[model samples]
Target: MNDTAHALGASRTLWELAERRAALTPDRPVLLQGDRSLSFGELRERAERVAAGLYGMGVRPGTVVAWQLPTRIETALLSFALVRLGAVQSPVIPFYRDHEVGFALRESRAEFFAVPGTWRGFDFAAMARRLGAKGVFEAYDGEGLPDGDPAVLPPPPAEGTSVRWIYWTSGTTSDPKGVLHTDRSLIAGGSCLAHALHLSPDDVGSIAFPYAHIGGPDYTVMLLLYGFPAVMFEQFALPDALEEYRRHGVTVAGGSTAFYSMFLAEQRRRPGGKLIPTLRLLAGGGAPKPPELYHSVVREMGVQLTHGYGMTEVPMITMGSPDDSAENLASTEGRPPEGMEIRIVDGEVRLRGEAVCQGYLDPAQTEEAFDENGFLVTGDLGRLTADGHLVLTGRLKDVIIRKGENISAKEIEDLLHRHPAVQDVAVIGLPDEERGERVCAVAEQAPGTAALTLAAVTAYLRAEGLSVHKLPEQLEVVDALPRNDTLRKVLKYKLRERYSGTVK
Candidate 1:
């Protein structure tokens, strides 16, 4: 990172950092969406107005506000507005329905909730009302967002150590855990990413994932630090979304391993033609990346692909730098940034850093999440190379990562056990070339019950209020699930080994 960016990164709060960046490059565009663009100056000024408006709506400093909006310029505006107000903001993914959404609102004790009204044909406002969410309001566009005079707003948050953000992660639990984070932690996480990628002011980036995700603040911090603009894709789909990428000259893109696979598939369709003429690098994290996929992307897509290690608890633990050797870049998850301590204890990855989150909403879970040494005990099993690169071998937790999102196997298993056709159930993640890992349910039929098909299993889970993204994509009926001799626990590894090859 350059001296200027490193100095700008020292700002105490996210709002302070935005103010500093806006002062430096007020006219430069910070966010691009289709034909629209938001300048750095406008981001600061308009967000203050929105903050004042939120003040008029009874939102005060320390007030808990939750928003479930898509990836759009307006979403960023509203988020920053909350930052300006020093409100404790909880972001719920738009893909989550009543189950996850309700859990977040209730756990966070959100005083105000912002929905997209009817987004992507789903009635979010109606659902919020149905869930009895407090202070429900619609804020999909700039016009819909609250606006008032900045004079009414109090001073922006001066401290970044206070927990101001609550991010949801399934982790190894059946229900989502609210991960606590502060502005300083998020800024530190983004700094690790921005510095590792070595982005320049000229580099155009794109966000193809949900803005409600922890990656939202992670990416926005990078933009603020580097003074670059990233295209905001409300709905990212190949072929259809290619035009905007080309229009904005997106130089850096890729949300996860799935995104790389999707781009590779598009490039394969055209053989020698470039997928995006200006594209240069594809970087992301959250899910496993196959070594072969890395080689394929560099050889076929004509771009540098760098994967990293991150989660809601620690947004950027390790990130592959563009300057690293191709071999290291392909095989390892890259090295941790300064101040991020990666310790391998009992073959599991434990992290302690400024970027690491404070803890979870549940006090007991928080107490159990960390070790005596104060390191966050990540359930991921990994090793450190002699050169400091991280090589993740497997996860100790029974969680399935599909397209960068964590899906709890036990959550699905518990729900599936309720099905009349399921006698025993074990949910495992199978290797998928496109999705990094695909959710597969291995089940045994109940006595005097019919066989369960994949379609039937998905429908049953969906009806049970499980998020669409968490539904199993494959199903296999067996006479019995493999169990260990000692505890009679279901051996999920055996199921994974048996079905790993079924996908690819």
Candidate 2:
């Protein structure tokens, strides 16, 4: 649509785009949570009211406001309100407890903290008080969301490059780092995802992950640009939520690799039938997708599974298109958008683009992250193919050095995913005196399947023509891999801690 391009090309700030889209499609559905839907027109009107109320609470331009809320319509409303007022917004994942929450509030020096009073049986207000959070208020249950006349609202933000979003890293390995983002950067990221998917106004999408995640805005901007609707799941669970997916006739569905695995598992329960009849594509990013999983989905689920590469710093870096070759979709993380620049320096993926974040909240960390050429050091070990598709090997720190030889965890994990008995697996390096580090594979067995052993795994890898040294030397089976609350990415650091023997 020409309007979509105009919004992507011309709008400087998110509020401007929201307003422009609202003018174009006032009554079109945008954010849908079950029976409740917020049209573009309502987004502008309600955000203005919320912004006015926040201003009444002394939340002036440049004010820092922090909120820890779940994936819900109210959360989006609060975030857009901050954008409307040009205030810096730091959204914490609802699952983060006081330890991370306190650090974010104190580090950001936030003027206010918003929380759900008693969401998921936890009293966030009590934690806010315990942490001595400033300007604490309940933002849900229709009790205390900022409310006032839209007539009192100030003009919406015009600048897009200013730092307005603060998203924290998952913090699996260390203290979470605060990554700063902007409207233009987020818009650029969202545009890449939208165009790559080739969505239409009649198409319907769904959100299966947390709304506070960076992907939230990335998906929201897609709706605004393309004039489509997406179902928002407050709490996503399989079979239970499958009814909703079918009810909405969702055309595109997926959160990440974990989400794809979850869908595949459900499909396996009842094979030879479409999980959602209307579903045509499964698209997502934020975690690695195994090649076998792609083949299985296309072969069984009867839908295209296009994965991509994205991080909190840059919500969307590259995205797999539906029209790409099966081999390309299975092996690569798609190609970068027109503005994105990807470089592989010593196997570390480096990026420089408008979609990239400004930097971290700490100046020193920011300085350390960017190279002299202003490229953001992604820390991810990867290489660009001849056609420019990114193929990530593993994290630079995640490489296991075994007797002076580096073992890529991703390569092993991808191979292991093909094994029938292995439901999900994580390859971690455990310390050993002789080998320096030993390759270990921890796996979750498929339902009703026999247990997998180290010998069997090694033999399978060997049969598949894997290097002898690259085959896992140790194997451990678990009920489930230790994963973070959001996106359910395997926490290999936790695995290392669990498997780390008493040695250097």
Candidate 3:
């Protein structure tokens, strides 16, 4: 391996450090999924077996291997195994249907696939086989596969050699885009995240987010780099997660607003209840977190609530550090971590840093995403505070122009979420003949709560002293809000699809 300091610019790649840690803590638990646990040595052995298996299958360096598996021990092992073999991984959420899976496969040009036969009552093998026939690689069965002899592969030629992963965007906006990340970028991002969270070898991180997302992968890499143990949960159930946190002594965890809400609901169900005491930090991102949820997490759980703002193209651009003020933690996505630069132009957020992805796989997209100056123009609309923190206003495309006023949909949605009966809310702009465009709010009411009328919503906005133009002219109550895998982010584009022209 290259010099640890040089490979990471100042540190080592997570896999590189993991090998050293495995030798140091061979019998220590490195991964836990349900009742099954794998020690560091066992995990390394299994990864070597998987690497040998891939070698036997004729997979070589630079090959793309797509994986769609739950957050199981094998999933973690296989992911590292692909890295050990110098292959790039493209992880897709297990919940992705055929259409989504096919889109990712096509975008990444994946040549090999790894999937579970069955997980959480779903038949992934059958589902995968059907999709594999359409062009993707055939799914390999992890359970019945033989453990081949251990074999070591050459390390990457050098830092930033070639692409290490092709991570797909969350697709909350339009079609999913593939973002290429080199080993240098991945190591930098992981180190930044680990430093931001103040993670150490004794820390045990419990991840509720899907492994397919950037947040999950970054968290995993951070923990492994620090030689910390991580607890992976396949499904997101608040009570079960709480039990796991308490059982595993999990120190750090992260999820979306929906997860915090579920955890809050569970806490209310018990007498004088609270989240596990071992949880030192609770982080939420991928969407705007309600102030009430933030307050509750800090008040009830005795843990700080933090939020991060980033995209797949630039993961962990800004996050609230553990030392940040409570108001900073609650009000904005804290300043950029070390070795990163962020700026605001015409209300659009732009980024430039070592942690930024190389570029999109599509040449056109790569050209479009970055400007001539090489700064990535994030489609997000936000402003940098005087203190350098980022306050997200709304998405640039989601801006509502009614008459002549530019209305921020996120501002209105944040107001609506504060309503007593509103459990979740999303704001979008719909076509309007006279006004140019009108503001619309789609909300999901709390359980057993009565539906809200447009007039009532308008009255609430007026009572809160919001400007007339900021009030949503139209409101729709639905059983549930359409969200991406994290369940924290609202798919406003989908809302636009359903109600863009239907609004009166």
Candidate 4:
């Protein structure tokens, strides 16, 4: 870690870190979107003003605010403003719809809700109203954001260990669990990421994913720690977003395995040419990276590809450093930073660290998530290398990660069961080179019903309000889904083994 950053990392809260960074690098750009930029100084100053504006609206410390906005500069500002007020924040991914969003709002009991109005033809404001959300407000642009004098703002939070964040992650079943976190935990996570990447102020980063995701604060903390700027993409589609990346001279980029594949696909379009002339490193987590994909990025794109392992519970646990060996970089998920302990108990990965979340929102869920040793029981199955790198084998949870987003198998299965043509269904994640994992639905047709097609299944899921990303990419009709003779439970592993490479 940089000596200056290490010293700044000792700050008690995210607001303190932002204030410290602003004091040191007031003029330095911290966030870039299109032709506009927010400097470290401006981030603190504007956030305070926004905080005062929020306070005038009855928001106060400990208020639960839920925001489902895109990856935009205004979104970052709104989030930091909430942090400034010491309010508990719950950010929902923009891709999530009525099912997930409604559940998040209801579970979080958010006192205030922020949306992007009619974003990309979707009426999020209307959806919020439909969900009967409290204090619904549109936060689409700077002009629409509430503004007031910073002088009216209260003192920034001094304590950092109090749980102030609620991040949602798909669980073993249909409902998403709210993973609790504190400011200190998030700081530790960002420090691990910033230190592992060994980023300098000269480096420019890019955030292509939804800022509402856990990676939002994770990435923002890196900027505050390193005093660097990152380009924000609200609607990140390939080829179109590339121009902005090149325009900003992004040196570090990559959101997940899917992002890597997208960049590689663009690079292949112009063989023997640099995808982004200034690009030097590709780094991300939240999805699996095939070893071959790593080698391909290094060989073809001429950039260092360092993958990591993280989740909503612990934003960053292990991350591959740029100085690591190619073999280690290609295979392992990298090494944990100081204070992060990784234990493999009974072939399952358990974590004990400052970055680990406090617990889930539900008390019983919290009790069940931790062990006697107090280590967070990560459902992932992995082992540590002799040298400290982590190599994940598989996951014990019934969740599919397609393009870095988790899709609950039971959620989709429950919806699929409603289809009249489906008698029984088993949803399994099949390995894919590009997406890391593809959602594949295998079904046994209902009596007197014909075989189901992927089109019909997807259409049904869409009508059921399932997100676009969770729709099954492949559909298979079998005489019977492989089930155990003991309790007649669907054998998902057998399905995975049978169809691992069978689907395209």
C-alpha TM-score for every candidate = 0.81, 0.98, 0.91, 0.81
Model 4, C-alpha of 213: deviation from truth (Å):
0.6
Question: What are the per-residue Cα lDDT tens digits for candidate 4 across 1-504?
Answer: 789989988989999999999999999999999889999999988888889889999899999999988888889889999999999999988878899899999999999999999988999998988899999888877587888987887888889999999998843235889999999999999999999999999999998887877888999999988999999988777899989988999999998876786798688788978999999999998865667678878999999999999988999999999999999998889999999999999988999999999999999999999999999998887889899999986667677889999777756876776687875677899999999999999988876776699999999999989999999999889997764221123567788989997855
Give the alpha carbon lDDT tens digit for every residue of 1-504 in model 1.
999899988989999999999999999999999779999999999999999999999999999999999999989999999999999999988888898888899999999999999988999999998999999989977589999999998889889999999999842226889999999999999999999999999999998888988899999999999999999999878889999999989999998876786798789788968899999999998776767678879999899999999999999999999999999998899999999999999888999999999999999999999999999999988899999999987677666888999887756765775686775677888889899888898988866777688988898999999999998888888987775221133567778778888952
Clashing pairs in 2: none
What are the candidates' C-alpha RMSDs?
11.1, 1.5, 3.2, 11.0
> Which regions in candidate 4 have their CA more than 4 angstroms from the true location?
171-173, 397-504
Error of 3 at 1 (Å): 23
Q: List the residue pairs that clash in candidate 1.
A: none
Candidate 2 RMSD computed on C-alpha atoms after optimal superposition onto the true structure: 1.5
- Using lDDT as the yardstick, the better of models 3 and 4 is 4
Error of 1 at 262 (Å): 0.3
Whole-model lDDT for model 4 versus the true structure?
0.88
lDDT of 2 by residue, 446-484 (tens): 888777877889999999889998888788899989888
User: On TM-score, who's better, 3 or 4?
Assistant: 3
Quantify all predictions' global Cα lDDT against the true fold.
0.89, 0.89, 0.75, 0.88
> Residue-wise lDDT of candidate 3 within 454-503, one digit each (tens)?
99999999998889878888888888988766546677778888997684
> Whose lDDT is higher: candidate 1's or candidate 4's?
1
Between 1 and 3, whose TM-score is larger?
A: 3
